[model samples]
Target: MDRSEYLVHLGNLEFFHVKTGCCDADLPAQYFCITMFQIIVEGGRNMLKTIHSTVLSADVEDTGLNLAFCFTPECGDYEHEECVNQPNQEETSLDENLLMEEHWRKEESMHI
Candidate 1:
């Protein structure tokens, strides 16, 4: 089977960047997931890149990548502040907020 290419020109589309603490339209709410698989062939290796792109809903995903993020103008100061990455709460329950926060914190701290 052959794959078809499509165009989704997001011209003039803007959104808030709470992660960067800016309102710039740098990172839109566009996601492109690729489930990669590596296999060694005859004296060589290959990767199967399965793209599973999804536009984030009013909810979040657990792909371990920030390819999808929310982009809504700050309704209030509190909202914007909360939008910023916060500390992770220690608990046995599955805490997505903490995981995301920890991911960003690690990524940022490493860059620093």
Candidate 2:
């Protein structure tokens, strides 16, 4: 299969500068990067589990490249904040609360 047939768009690349709190001479702080992408495949929603496992097990050899795969469903009505990449959790909570309250107000207004 051609690369374009399965691989969709590779995006939302992020880099994090991780630091070690403990003073260790041997281990140094390193930068970690994560890249997100979209893939097209056969089967419907029911086959997600098999597809996920296959993708994760694609590479059997340990090449020192740590890989994590996750399939996030499309964001629903009230999941925008949780879906987006957020650096701060406290601020996210406050913002989410405010948004929820606003949504509630709109719902109440519609009922009234």
Candidate 3:
């Protein structure tokens, strides 16, 4: 597995956005419906050392519906099969300029 980067956004909000050396993506929908998530992944040939997950809130646990079905996984190995290793995962990436722009956009969104 090679390094992979992803930008998981929900409408105007981003939930999971980061870069990982070992590619893996199969996030469950339950991770977004709430303001907190307790994820547990198992059976990994290479144990996941760093796992980062975040859930935001609009006004105190509005609803636990978890509208997070939309998912996009980024993989550098475009030619190598199993991009995200998941049947539902997709390949994607944000360039440096796009990433910089997103950084400012994310910062601004956080302030509002």
List residue ranges in candidate 2 displaced over 4 A. 1-26, 46-79, 84-112
Each candidate's number of clashing pairs is 0, 0, 1
**If scored against the real structure, what TM-score would every candidate get?**
0.18, 0.19, 0.20
lDDT of 3 at 89: 57
List residue ranges in candidate 3 displaced over 4 A.
Answer: 1-84, 100-112
Model 1 residue pairs with clashes: none
lDDT of 2 by residue, 1-112 (tens): 0010011222333221111121122323211111233333456531111121101112323344322222222422232545443465322232343455568778989999
Task: Put the candidates in lDDT order, highest first.
Answer: 3, 1, 2
Candidate 1's C-alpha runs over 4 A off are 1-94
Cα lDDT, model 2, residue 12? 35
- Residue-level lDDT of model 3, residues 24-102, one tens digit each, is 2332222222221123456754322224433322221334433332334442323245534569654343233345455
- Per-residue CA lDDT of model 1 for 1-112, tens digit only, reads 1111122212322122222111122433222221222222444753223222221222223433332223333423333434333465232211343355568778989999
Question: Which pairs of residues collide in model 3?
Answer: 33-66
Is 1 or 3 the stronger prediction by lDDT?
A: 3
CA shift of 56, model 2, Å: 19
TM-score of predicted structure 3 = 0.20
Cα deviation at 70, candidate 3, in Å, is 27
